[model samples]
Target: MMNFSLPMIFSFFMVLCGLWSFVKYHKHLLNSLLSLEFMMLGVFWLMGLQLTSVGMEIYFSLFFLTLAACEGALGLSLLIYVVRSHGNDYFSSFNLLSC
Candidate 1:
């Protein structure tokens, strides 16, 4: 039990670090998107560990991975669109009220 708990604790800290990075460097679109991906990966790792320890089917992890991939693709597309439209990925140039 001690061994299992140690890894679980480590994974939790991994997720927290991802969250911290996301909050710390959220001014740029690309940085925030990368941080989000990092968080997703950490969560995926945690889910896999928990599921395996519980002896549950691992299919859910695959599904979660698929969603993460889709999310990453979408974020990249958005980043591209923003860069093309605004000439950069900085949030200050977004101009949310401009329509």
Candidate 2:
């Protein structure tokens, strides 16, 4: 009998989504951001599922969520600038904007 724990499943989602974010990150900006958010959410979910101490998890999740929101905001702003300046959303094109 192969029984999968909830935390284990969530952890797999975290790793898989994290890998996906890194693999395609240099190709498309929007897709990469979405995948990164997915990975972050997976981390939040796993923390909720696997924590032994409710108090610790609550504080950790609060801090993590705050950081995630800041990251998402910065990513979205860069995405907007990339799209407006390049007239496209590819990561390579955005890199050209810096030079």
Candidate 3:
């Protein structure tokens, strides 16, 4: 069946990684952020697999990859700032909204 294809396998792996990241996030900010990225990658791959046209699918995949890169860059920059301010990246220490 089509469900047993490579794309499905990869997508399943992505979900598993995302779940692991979410679980790890409670203990570390970096882990959570990376987990979010893992989930995004799954979405990107699925989007590419949904289309039938090879040319169009490639374009969509490229677009998704670009978005993913942007996300990683922004997340990394934010992480850098947070680490500089707190000397570490931990979810429990984040209380900017508690004022």
Candidate 4:
């Protein structure tokens, strides 16, 4: 039986906090992006701990981190584009249905 250590519990709460923050403050694009990153990091932490406990390789965690970085970059680019064109990053101000 695997023991649930303090670090693992902390990581689990971290992920929960991230999700809560994402849902509570999703109006601004920047807040949403930051919350997403927070969730990714928390997941990474949990993955690393679980893999280490199971004596499994950590290559998957590295791949996940790489993908997270790519996602962050893409999100930032989108934010920049929105801010440049609309002068703000609020979803309510940016109309997606317009041509």
Best by lDDT: 4
Computed on alpha carbons, the lDDT of every model, listed in order, comes to 0.90, 0.77, 0.80, 0.94
| Alpha-carbon deviation at 39 in model 3, angstroms | 1.6
Residue 2, candidate 2: alpha-carbon lDDT: 50
Top candidate, metric TM-score: 4
| TM-score: the better of candidates 1 and 4 | 4
- Between prediction 1 and prediction 3, which has the larger lDDT? 1
What digit string (tens of lDDT, one per residue) describes model 1 on residues 1-99? 346587778788888988998999989999999888888988999899999998999999999999999999999999999898899998988888875
- Candidate 1 wrongly placed segments (more than 4 Å): 1-4
What C-alpha lDDT does candidate 2 achieve relative to the native structure? 0.77
Clashing pairs in 4: none
Q: Which 10 consecutive positions of candidate 1 have the poorest summed lDDT? A: 1-10
Which residue pairs collide, candidate 3?
A: none
**Candidate 2 TM-score, C-alpha based:** 0.75
Compose the digit string of candidate 4's lDDT tens values, residues 1-98. Answer: 97899999999999999999999998999999999999999999999999998999999999999999999999999999999999998888977787
Tell me the spans in candidate 2 whose CA falls farther than 4 Å from its real position.
1-4, 52-57, 95-98
Q: lDDT for model 1, on a 0 to 1 scale? A: 0.90
State the lDDT of candidate 3 residue by residue for 1-92, as single tens digits: 45467876788789788988688666877887789888988977777776642345377678878989998999999999889888799867
How many clashing pairs in candidate 4?
A: 0
Candidate 2: clashing residue pairs, number: 0
lDDT of 1 at 56: 100
